[model samples]
Target: MAVSAEDFDHRCEPCLVIDQQIEAHGFCVDCQEYLCKNCFSYHQRIKATKHHHLVNKDNMAKHAVIKESDECTEKCQVHKKEVIKFFCPKHEALGCKDCIVLDHRACDIDYIPDKCTGIGDSAEFREVLRELDQKVNEVEDIIKLAACRENELDSCHDRLIKEITMFRKEINDRLDQLQKQIQTDVDRKKFTDKQAVKNVVETCTNISSDIKQRQSRLQDYKASQQNGQLYIILKQAKSKLKSEEIKEADRSLEKTNMQYTFEQNQDLEDMLSRQNAFGKLALSSSL
Candidate 1:
């Protein structure tokens, strides 16, 4: 079988304990040795050596340089005696002649280096790099916008707190004014009621003094045995007792107890409970 250039590119380093014809499937960094698949599997399965790190043969191509000056000696993994000679583009794989005949007979095949040549200068390659740069810029913009939004969120929070505090203070100040007005009304009513009671007491005191004076005069009149004077004094006392001022004062003092009560405004309480002053925050649909 004719060995392809891809074989040279993927050629594994020679195993220490095996013939050069056997290709390595893995490389152990600790032991610094190339291993066939069977040996690599055995090394990992062993409890004593399982912890050691290993790199796959395919991945080692980038780090390991296979010189073109050296003879092609690496064998295929499937056909152990045959070397890889062609790359299948449809399958995106490297294979020996037997592998191509068995699994990729209908697939388009090409020389690896020839297919890959001038790829760096291709428009598709440049477009890919351009898209990557654009994606990076977009990510950067997103990060910057997010950072700005974070600051805005903090600022908005502080502003809302300040507004709420000011609003609360205004409510408190209004409440204080309301309290003072209610207190003033209470004081005014108290003064008016007290003055009414004072006036009633003064009128009753005057009536009591007049009745005592009339009683004294009648006693003197009776002692002198003057029936006319006694009759006149009794008549005057009866007339004074029936006076309008005395009758009105009696009725005024009967209903003199001033009563008052305070109750909370349900509408105001409901509004406070529902709205709570500090509004709600919501995400925009655009975001």
Candidate 2:
């Protein structure tokens, strides 16, 4: 009969140390080493390693291939010579039998491999991934909202500048109108004063001409011995010289003097000063 690959026994790893070619009959799960029948008997008989878990070679071949270092062959940190095979759920720790009996006596305990069965496909793993995705979406939403707020701030700033420019133009326009109105009033007053002064000069010239004519008439009368006409002329001249019309005209001119000035508006000044802080930004805690 031809030998089959499946029926062929693997060489024992420990037997190779003595250059012996013993066939492996089992695998030590804790020690992660192949064992022959003789070595398996010796492994079971040992006091320290007697409780170490073992699996038949046929059963071990059906499981996933495991690296020796990645296996449960790790020695317990507290119990140096013991392998860690049990997990304590209550304390959330892994340890050897001695460590579990000493520190986690009353804790819920189980084999580490048994608890790890189908963990990758478990619902809790999916739920954790879902929660992480939700957190990422929330962070993205916050970033989008912040970008919108930045745009709003920029728009508000531009609008404020536009409003300021508009108000400034309005103020300048109003000031121009007021200045024009004041100039118009000044021009009218000037024209009226000039006309009044011209009238005064015309009246004075007419009075002087009348006085000269009366003096000439008096001389003619004196030459002809007309004393009565000369006396009448002197009485008219005295009344005309005592009139108060010229004094009244000088007082009216003095009253036409106008003074223009601007008064400050404290409220408007305060409002303008506060323009330094046009807008304020605040964050919402709801995020």
Candidate with best TM-score: 1
Candidate 1 ranges with C-alpha deviation above 4 Å: 1-133, 224-232, 273-287
Best by lDDT: 2
Q: List the residue pairs that clash in candidate 2.
A: none
At residue 99, candidate 1 shows an lDDT of 76
TM-score of each: 0.52, 0.45
Predictions in order: lDDT: 0.73, 0.74
lDDT (10s digit) by residue, model 1, range 1-287: 97653564332332321223446777776554566787788889999879877889776544443335332355789999977656787887887767777787677775333345466889989999999999999999999999998998899889878887898798899989988999998888778888889999999898889899999999999999898999999899889878888888978876667477777778777777886444565556643
User: 29 in model 1: Cα distance from truth in Å?
Assistant: 26
- lDDT per residue for candidate 2 within 1-287, as digits (tens), equals 96543565676755643445677888887766678889988999999779988777787565335554344688989889978878877887988877766777777677665456576789988999999999999999999999998998799779868888887798889878977988798788778877876776776677678878877887887888877987887787678679776676666656655565556567766866895533444555532
For candidate 1, the 10 contiguous residues with the lowest summed lDDT are 10-19
